[model samples]
Target: MKNGEYFISKDKALLQTETIHQFLSRSYWANRRTLAQVQASIENSICYGVYHGTRQIGFARIITDWATMYYLCDVFIDEEYRGQGIGRRLVDLIVQSEELDGLTGVLGTKDAHGLYESFGFVRDPDRFMKRRPTNPWA
Candidate 1:
């Protein structure tokens, strides 16, 4: 989808792996992820990349069953490109995509709740649960 000078696409082939690794490595959620891990994750998930002409400026991924549920993760817009509604459009496409519509969507965020909430995400602390990896570096 095109938005002004930016566009979003689900073509994994269009993703710039090095650029994505760079962005994710510094992210609060994926800070510990290695380049290989990021690559593996992208290969396994339905991926999206936001681009300006040719350079990728944003990314997101959805781990889903295509029928029941999907976990949205690794969502980010370049620090230089934020505040431009690029992230919003990237997510809007994912949530409303035919593959994800009608399925339960969940995400984890220490901040930026407002962003997701605007798209119908509600905090469910009581129902949410997680099991941390035993190896911190794993």
Candidate 2:
């Protein structure tokens, strides 16, 4: 695989597991995720990975009802691979995907707001709410 080339976006269960592991190892929000746990999560997600000759350099996942709302999550691009438009292309592919076509796409990011904004994602203060467990270990 080269830039702008991907093997396929479907049948991604196994590939998703690997992609998550690669990301969580580097991502602050998910650095504690174990391979077994990540594998289980991958089995239940609609995931996409961008590859460069068999190495996954970017990844994202969407959890959705497939009818109305889609939460895009875990987007990442390897540091060495940034500025190549891979992240933008990944978002484009997801937004344009027939599987997600008429649903609302949502995501939360501490950074990269500009990138998502370029794709028509806006901060809708009235539509967002969140809760975090007081004791996540429980």
Candidate 3:
């Protein structure tokens, strides 16, 4: 729970939809991602929020079956909070969580390879492929 000046909580109430919408809409990997899509994702996934007391500073989600595999996604820290080790601490807590035990984990990041690598992630260039929705809004 407590990691230095930050802490991780699994409270969905801590999520600010407007703030998440604004950040993801501008992110290269998920540009223009609609609020409905974001809401749907949050509703379905296991969400973790990083907080400094009552302030939500970061978030991450895992889409998983809990018995086999999990895909970590939407991991982000507020731009103002990046320099601290909060991001790393957040990820470490997730990876070590009992809920995800014994599952193969995967994540996609255009960058941040170094950060993820520290947590036992590696390139699987030949093992992964993706297909985007033909009509994201549809």
Q: Which prediction has the highest lDDT against the true structure?
A: 1
Residue pairs in collision within model 1: none
Candidate 2, residues 2-108: lDDT per residue as tens digits? 35554335448437466669678788777777788777766788888777767777778889998899999888888888997888888988888898989999999
Which stretches of candidate 1 lie above 4 Å from their native place? none
TM-scores for all candidates: the values are 0.96, 0.85, 0.93
TM-score for predicted model 1 compared with the true structure: 0.96
Better of 1 and 2 by lDDT: 1
RMSD of every prediction:
1.0, 2.4, 1.3
Off by over 4 Å in 2: 1-8, 13-19
Q: What is the lDDT of candidate 2?
A: 0.78
Q: Report, for every candidate in turn, its global Cα lDDT versus the true structure.
A: 0.92, 0.78, 0.88
Model 2: ten consecutive residues of lowest lDDT: 1-10
lDDT string for model 3 (37-115, tens) is 9999999999998877777878898999878999999888989999898899889999999889899999999989999
Tens digits of per-residue lDDT, candidate 1, 1-138, equal 888888999889999999999998898888898889999999999999999999999999999987899999999999999898889988889888988879999999998899999999999999988997899685
- How much lDDT does candidate 3 score? 0.88
